[model samples]
Target chain A: MNTSDAFHRYTKKVCGQIRWKKAHDIVSREIENHLHDQRDAYMAQGDTESVAEEKALLQMGDAVSVGMALDQTHRPSPQWAMIGLVMLLSGIGAIIQFCYYDNALAAAPAGNISIARFAFALPLGILLFAAAYFLDFSFIGKYPYLLPVALLGIDIVAQLIGVDFNGKNWLSIGRFAISPISLSLPFPLAFCGLLYHFRHKRNGYLLGGLFAAFFCVQLVCFHTMSGLFVFVCAAGSLMLFAAVRGCFPGNTKRLFLLFVVAGIVLFAMFLWANSYYAYRMNTLFAVFRPETDPQNVGYFPLLLRNIMEHSVFWGKGNPLEIADYSAILYSGNFRADFLLTFLSYEYGWGIAMFLVLLLTGFLAFGLHKAFRQKSILGQMVSLSILCTFAGEVFVYILNNLGYPLIAPIALPFLSYGTTALLLHMALAGILLSTFRTGEVFRDKELLTFLKPPLFQWDNGKLIISFKG
Target chain B: MTMDKTLLAGSTAMLILKLLDGQDMYGYQMIAELAKRSDDTFHLKAGTLYPLLHGLEKKKLLESYEKQTDSARIRKYYRLTPKGKKHLHEKTEEWEVFSHAIHQVLKGGLCCEHI
Candidate 1:
């Protein structure tokens, strides 16, 4: 047989069985290169091309066994602990939804219509998560433009003529009332993968920043007010990711310019548009002086404070009923925002604090895991996802605690929105696929970090130990 | 002495880690170096080496970065991380104990009549 044929057979046997098909190309190249080197060495020792090739192929040993070994080595290992934690939170979310639904039906007469958005969320989340976890995430980078282009097209069209909900902020699809926000959620993720993949090329970051800025502009003009904050944070993260990776050589100026432009536009739009967005800023007053606006926007902050103060270490009280989603929903009550409040009331402060720790630990471990990725694109996407997650969680918790710099960006798995929950699970799946090859955290640091130190000696041993 | 194929495959990771503790090396460089250093005994194959290298990286025992040569070929170089260095030390210690025991058995020091 020809050298090419032998080489092809060798690689096919080696990489064909691997689940992460994206790694196959690199695996084949490395093997082919090795074979060529061995063949060249034999040729130097007075062997003909075909003879050298045969000898080289012979030295590789059995193709089937080698392939199997490789398959075993590169097989993806799911981070089950992290997956379990996310599932636990989602379980609590489901229970919360059930509880709210029960109470809402009891409060209403009888014929109130229940929103089925969350009914499909769990099943859809499972499907999307499984698909993302099983498939190679590198495909996102491979066909990057497909998702971003489609989303932009949809968003632009939605902005132009799509049916509006509640004074032109949210765009809903025909008949089924599918929110355009849900459709646009996956674009940032795919865009970051492409950016990381193309960071080395000329005009890469500039072009990426330009597209991103244009997208941000579209989001701004489209007035996806609730989604606009998430878009800003996600897009900002991608830019920061590019800057840190330094993938775009000498294009920092253009990126910075785009950031400033988008920043100004988003800030101005927030000020000009949504009153609820404006109401969130009044949260600082609620924290410091609760009596200032006792009747208005100060109610949530003061209510949260009261809940914390009256709350036991383990909650013995009933779950707090906050947002009356019944007016909007046809049937069940919408507990859309108030995640932390619900956690404290239902599971108690103990479980709530424990979950807070879990969230922090999970994201920290994810960020650490991303650095260990051998693939630059994996690292980039991982960082982008982690940053977006971190930003949302931080803002969400802070907003709950009375420093509401951002509006109610819902908690990841615990939030009530169908689209938010589905997107969250899918992001987790992508994160899993990225860190599938790497250790989630190193050297038992998580346990140590979570555990209170045995020693409290401030003389020399124990410094500041952080509580979750 | 000839070794079992499974045994050779098993030792490749430790052998690669052992080689890498001294210096960083790329794929082809590693193959050549291992052959040269082992006097062609271990005979590390390239097909197995890349996957093994990648596995080690995933375990956080190694880190890699790419550099371009004057000839413009991108070369991926692997080095022992701090975690990897600590792991290598432990592996070396284990190997020393295991090999010493094996040597004792081979040198007619152990009684295997029961077996």
Candidate 2:
């Protein structure tokens, strides 16, 4: 073989052993550079070019053996620890549901359906998680609007033919009913991609803002205020983050101020127009001082306070004996919204604290790893998921503690509902999928063209210059 | 003089990490530096060194970056990561204990009286 082509031939052979094709170019380049350096060093010691090349080629050893060694280390790295944690959380959810059914079923036989539903949902959620975990999440970046648009389309259809439960619309097929609110949870993740796709374009924020507004209007139309709140909070934070990171065209601080003022004024007007919402806001305030509305809106808060106060640290606490009120406390709603309080009441504050700590630990671990990722798409998508979990857990804790600031959102994996469970598992899968391929996957579309360095040093004097 | 393959293989990663503990170096530079520092007792081949460096990087013990040298040649330099430094520290301690034991055994004297 010719001397120059010999090095190329060696690199090709070495890279052929590496099964992951993406790593081939990188491995090839490094090996080829080393060969060239070796050749140059030999030539510097007075060998002819051809002799130097021969010596350098011999120094690299067997191509196949080197490649085999490299192949072992260059394989795809899956986050097994994170995967175990996710499954652990899912298992905890099942145990909590089992506890609820075992305790409350004799009192309310209707609780049997929930147990049956849980059986069905758990497998389906796992199946979806598996699917999402293997899924290349970059498609969200490729088609940024696909998830949000599909969700909106589903919601629209649900509004037309879906079943209504307590005035909120849910898409139902057979025994499984998919809450539109749960469907809306992925909006922020999709928005991350949407923002990324338009980050470099002029007037991209305008298009992005309209897309968010459309989703908000749909949620408001369906009267899913909790979903609307989540969608806005998560999407708003993403937009603000993008703006601050110079993803948007305008001044980030000014745009953020404008959005805050606009949101407050609109929210106030809505409250002024809607007395029911206004009353709910007042009830939020009156929760701490339950004596003001003891017979009415403050009733639940007072009961919650009484239950928490009476609960012990480790074992079962004294059950409230207010007749029908206690019966209501043992219903399915208690399993979904007041899970922490229910657990505290039945088990103890210790178990509740354990659950809280476990959830916090998982979220903190995810946030730390996600933030460490260099890819922008991975960071943005993970931020959205982490924010959703943090927001839900925060709201759930407040509502359970008797504040009732907003309608209680499910505590992610811990809450009891088929669609909610399925959605959360799917989201978790996406998160794990991101962590799995984060190091290798790059969103070429989102990558900005780096300008040449504008600052340089000449003769040890620092020079700064501007670039056009 | 050739060292035992297994012995060389076991210590190759430790030697490479120790070299990088001083400063970042390209593949060829590491090979040359190892020979010089070990007084020609260690002669790491390009094949062995590159794979070992890549393996260390995969474990996050090392990180690589490219920089243009004075000759305008872009060289891929590998440096010890914080994790790698900690790993090297542990390996160094283990090696000292192991070599000391071997020395005592070879001399027919137990410097460490426990065994």
Candidate 3:
């Protein structure tokens, strides 16, 4: 039986009262079905078709009232606890700069510019975060190709004409040099969009792998092993998750095994091909034997180890009577790379442990929220964001503890880099956005209907049907 | 005999939960079952039922899934979650205590005819 015009008008009116567009389709469909069932029942009781529909419409009660109720329940609520944690972390980062590094920064000519730049970057980073938080993240899926292509194009342009900063190409953005390599930070998000786009196609995983290779190459070309490591971990996990979730078009287990094997082989090849990476690995192993080479590669680690060894748990460690105190303070990128060491040396190891635990707890909470999402896209996006943040913290802590496996990536909100600060803020925005709208974002392409089982017993068969 | 709308309104969520405790049910089916079980005393509006159901779902107290009925009509069915079941048990206990108190106060060992 066809639904009458009156039924359509009623549902439309009800949907109009719902402020959230995402909830409209679901609410409309459920209401439509309820109306149909009522109309059918009335018609069975000898009512005319028109009369039944009219009665059904009337019995549903006021459309506006129902819509208003649904609107109240359907609206996306911000994750206040997560937001508070983010703000707290960002504040700690700012405090680290102004309190510990301020005098050191003021003493140098470029430090004045750095401090001014940090002052400029803080609120600007918060604004970028706000913008990202309020943004409709569904646009990532809608224009899957455009985002990656644009980011890659920017990187290419930056490489060709950008200023060289510390042996890496950086786009000069008016007194602020932005690392084009950091542009790869959102590759996991872009990759998710591409996965959604190619969900129905054959060898889509291959395309995803190829896309990852391209970004990984960009990170490699820039010699940012930390960025490369982070991108691979975040984006690689996203791909693996998409496959496990059956968002791709092949045998899931086979694809999973293939990914694992490919990852191992490529990683081996990468390590073998790069002598610098090999040296970094060798240095990582040398961490335990820092005393053996105390004057060369182990100089800083040994210095750090000695300070930590002497440092008390709660208060200031023994007075700094070292002859090379200036050398320790003026180490390369001391504010960003060795801030944790300085923090521990001055304030005590307790604070350092607390900071690490706080960061770990925050990331764990984020991952938990991400896993609870009903939408695969939200899960993938959240995983990437959390992975990047967690990976940075892990590397920072490891390097701080005298392990120096790779150069220290910024410790997310606590580090003193404008670019990194801005990136963290923006990523926080995306993470908050995912948590805010996580439930309502159903990837339409991924809504697969499973065929019910057909049973046969003694030549009698029961066939189950599924319709899209 | 129809109950007061206010009384029915207060108990609608509990009644719905009780009805679904036995089996998963669609919106229309729940409404019909409520009326039948209440001997036509309950007349739940579709408008009220859906919003209530959705609110419960948002709280993770209920979960909904779509499946085709035997009659070839696609129906969205609601199932009570573990949380919802726990809630129902608590509500039932609270209701029993309140109703028993009301009964004792109203009777007071005196017949209505004497009054």
TM-score leader = 3
Over B12-94, each residue of candidate 1 has an lDDT whose tens digit, in order, gives: 77889988987998877888898899797767766577768888986889887655455334456889999998988888898
| Worst 10 contiguous positions by lDDT, candidate 1 chain A | A438-447
Best candidate per DockQ, number? Answer: 3
The two-chain DockQ for each candidate, comma-separated, is: 0.23, 0.43, 0.53
Task: Report the C-alpha lDDT of model 2 over A1-468, residue by residue, as the tens digit.
Answer: 655479989999998898977668567767877887889899999998799998998999999999998898887568788888878889999888876754343222123346667787799899999999988877778898788777778888888987776676777677666766567677778777887888757877776776666666666676466666777778777777777667767776657764775476447545643558768766876787887988888888887777888689989887676776577667876767888888888889898899899889888989998876646788788888887777778878888887776776688888766677888999999988888776655556322222224675754866564641
> Candidate 2 chain A: worst 10 consecutive residues by lDDT?
A444-453
Residue pairs in collision within model 2: none
Instruction: Give the number of the best model, judged by lDDT.
Output: 2
Candidate 1 structure quality by residue, lDDT tens digits, A1-468: 657578878888877666666557556655766676788789999999899998888877677767776677665677898788778877877876765643343332222214464566577887888777766666666677876776767667766766655344334432133345444456567668567656667877657766665666565565454355666677677777667766667766766875777667667666765556545556655667777886676655666665555456775544335443213222333245556655565557786778678788889888777876756567767877776677667767776565544455567777655556777888888888777743222112222332435555643755444442
Report the C-alpha lDDT of model 3 over A1-468, residue by residue, as the tens digit: 345457768889999998988777677767888998999899999998788998999899999998998888998878889888888989998987776555453323233335667788899998998898988777767788987887777777878878776667777667776655455566666666786676657877777777777666666775477777777778778877878788777686769765976587558646754767766765765787888777777777777677677677888777656768546644445756877777787788898888888898899999889997877778877888898887778778877877776676688888766677888899889888988987777666423322223432322645433332
At residue A379, give the lDDT of candidate 3. 83
Candidate 2 regions with alpha-carbon error over 4 angstroms:
A1-12, A20-61, A98-114, A200-214, A236-277, A445-468, B1-8, B22-43, B63-79, B93-115
- After best superposition, candidate 2 residue A108: deviation in angstroms? 16
